[model samples]
Target chain A: MKLLELQAACAAYGQSQVLWSIDMEVEQGAAVALIGRNGVGKTTLLNAIAGVQKLTGGHLKFGGEDLTATPAHGRARAGIGFVPQGRHVFPHLTVMENLTVGLAALAGRKAVKESGIASHIFDLFPKLTQIKNRKAGLLSGGEQQQLAIGRALAGQPRLLLLDEPTEGIQPNVVQQIEAALRRIRTELGVTILIVEQYLDFAWSFAEAYHVMQRGRIIRSGSTAMESASEISHLVNI
Target chain B: MHESAFLIGQVFNGISVASLFVMAALGLALSFGLMRVINMAHGEMLMLGGYLAYLTLLVVPGPLGILVAMPVAFLGAAFLGGILELTVIHRLSTRPLDTLLATWGVSLILQQAARNLFGAIGVQVVAPTWLDHTISFSTGILSGLTLPDTRLFILLVAALILGGVALLINKTRLGLYVRAVNQDRPTAAALGVNARLVDLTVFALGTGVAGLAGVILALLGPVTPTVGQSYIVPAFLVVILGGLGSLVGTTIASLMVGLFTALIEIYVDVSVAQVLLLVFVILFIQIRPQGVIAVRSRALEG
Candidate 1:
């Protein structure tokens, strides 16, 4: 079952067009990677699909439902979770408060009560429990990333978009994050779309890969050994 | 009376004045601090609230009229504020200067409309019997300490409004949405929060609270069409000096400004005191531009 499909999509930030008639697809329960060097439209494409950026042309569908015109909030309500780059956590709010912010989407006022969803997040990142009362800003980089992902999952999303989750994270925590994401994909059956710059990370985790360059996916293939080297060679290291 | 007694009396006077400023500044902070709009028409909303109180008197025409006026003025001003937010402010949310100029124009237009409707002459607002006396102390070292009944009323109203606002923002379910909007608008919306609706509600709540302030002000003296003009600057100062997006900061700043102005006016001319206070605020801003409390959020940092 196709979960997301983008056909000939075009997008721009003011005068600079960042995505040019890009075509992409993600099947249900599939772990897909969008890999590219810096300055490519990898993040921009994800933003368009997330409904944060409006596409200039073409169509986007999620769960066989048209989502080209849906606004970001509506898309969120429809169960597309996004953990944007830079771990944009609410710094002033407490850890518990930050988790509750994700529950805001389920229902206004009524869903605001403390619920069991938080315990699941605690299970995923148990460190959040000890410092639940502390402000989220004071958390370490890895903990903040976990909180960001945990916060997104609190919305009970059917699909997740993670952009550079391991950008500045330490190696041990990076392994832990990958393990958590794998659990989210296989155990929870949530569709995963990750944007990454590291060849080893993307190739190992994602079942298939899309290689982007200068606002276009120049080549794509299964995560085979020959294709992985070929994709890596296509870019200047 | 001893010098200490005189000082205590002036301190009390300053606190009462600060109470009034807090009532006015709460709305100013809500509009400027949260929405990021320099709503120059805020004074006009205050004036409109005064007019609503006057209209309430005409309809009820007794002690009962004062009772009817408070909620009517608050709701009326809130409704008007919501309309203005929808029609003008929302369109210019990103353009602070343009929003400021447009609201200034609105202030002028509203003042003109009020003058045309109620005439240029000031309209008298009658205070009830409960508000007609002063609580005075004339014994021991505290001889000649006098607190006006009206000032006491202002204090009560301020306490009630501040308490109500604190509860609404801190404890209620709507407060969650408000805080989310304040903290990270993009993330909030992406998490399925209706950010626009939250903006409209916060704007209306601030304007409505300002209307409550006007009701308290109306009983003090003549309710003129330009009554709001006198307080808007002080209210802005309170918000700025207190800091952006901190209610506690606004409260502390209000008391500071009120005390500073009152104490200075005792030793110097009122106009001289004003100039000195401005200089002090300028120096303070130069030292710490974020005011008493700097906000820590993704929006502020980025």
Candidate 2:
């Protein structure tokens, strides 16, 4: 089943069109990476999907339901969880509180115990459980990244959208995140649609890739490229 | 010995005054802290609340009526604030200066309305029986200390309110939504939190609390259309001194301003103390703009 589909989607900022006629699709439980150069519509597209920015023209469908006019919070309740760029964690709230915030979407769901959610999150990232009492702002960048993902997961989303998770983090932490994403995909079967710039980092786990340029998807296919060098050439100057 | 007793009595007076400052400042702090809007009509909200209290006295007599009027006033003011939010404040939310000017306009309109309705003169809320008398106290070292029953009652009431607000902000789900919106409205909205609804609710809550403060002030003196004018500046000073958007900072700052005003009044002119307090706040901000309990956030940064 198609988890998400964007049909001829277009968005603009005060006369300057950032995303125009973009078409994209992700199947249920699929791991898809969206890549493009700097200043492209990657972030805009993600924002549109997450309902942060309303599309001027397009049809958005998730889980076989229309979502074109839904607000951001409404999108979350419909099982669309977003982890925005720069790890926008609530600095004052504790690690546990940040995670519980994700539960805002799961309020009406049956038997969604808070403790059970914590345990589930801890089971995914044990490092979070260790410092769960600490303020989110005090955490290291990598820890914050984990908390961001963990917080998104706490929403119990069927589909997770991540924007530039490894933007400024160390290499070792990136590897940890990759491992976690893989586990999330295979074990939990949560559909993921990621916007990433790092080729090797994204290409490793992504089952498929889409290249966005000037607000349009120009290229998309199976992950089997000729070589990493070719993939690097495809991504950057 | 008598000098020492007078000093102690003055200190008690300061503490009593602090409670009123805390109560009066609470709503303004909440509105400014969460929404980042300078609500110039915040004082009007309090004035309206006082009028509500005075009106309540006509229907329900005595202290029991005062108790009932609190929730009633809160609801009425909240409803009025909600209307303003929808009509004016919400539209100008993105423009802080515009919001300030718009709310200031609203304040003027409210004051005129109050004057036309209640007249330029003020109405008095009859003091509750329990708070109508002064109480005398004496410790081993200090004798002949007297505390006004009104101040005592108000002090306890303000403390209870502070406790309630703290608990609500820290422990409740509504608080989670509030804090989330306060820190980052866009991110909170993206997380499926109703940021707009939260803003409206907070606006109402703040105005409701202001109504309660008006009722308390009415007990001390008459409720006039211009009563809020005298309060608006001091309440704003307390909010800013406490730190923008920091509830704990507001609480501590209100007490500090209250006590300092009381202390300085003993030795200096009341007007001089006001000027000095402004200078102190200016210096304090210059040194530590973040405040006593500022949260770590990059929400304002590019």
TM-scores of the candidates in the order shown: 0.94, 0.94
| Candidate 2 lDDT tens digits, B164-252 | 88888889989988888887777788777888888899888888888888888888889999998888787888887887767788888
Docking class of 1: medium
**Candidate 2, residue A195: lDDT:** 88
What is every candidate's C-alpha DockQ against the true complex, given to 2 decimals? Answer: 0.52, 0.53
Scoring only chain A, what TM-score does candidate 1 earn? 0.92
Q: Can you give the lDDT of residue B285 in candidate 2? A: 85
Question: What does candidate 2's lDDT look like per residue over A1-237, in tens digits?
Answer: 899999999999989999989888999989899998887889999999999988999899999999999999989888898999888988878888888788887755564544436566788888998998998878888999999999999888889999999889999988888888888888888999998888776777787898888888888876765344555665796
**Chain B TM-score by candidate, in order shown:** 0.95, 0.94
Candidate 1, residues B1-302, lDDT tens digits: the string is: 66767888889888988998998888878766667887898887778878888889888887678878999989998998999899999999888899989999999998989999999886877887878898877887877777888888888888888899889887876776677778777777777777888889988988888888888788886778899999999999999998876788899999999999989988999999999999989999999898887765344333
**What ranges in model 1 sit over 4 Å off?**
A108-116, A224-227, B297-302
Q: How displaced is residue B294 in candidate 1, in Å?
A: 1.0
Best lDDT goes to which candidate? 2
TM-score of chain A of each: 0.92, 0.94
lDDT by residue for model 1 (A36-100), tens = 88889888888888787889999999888898998888787777888888888788777777777
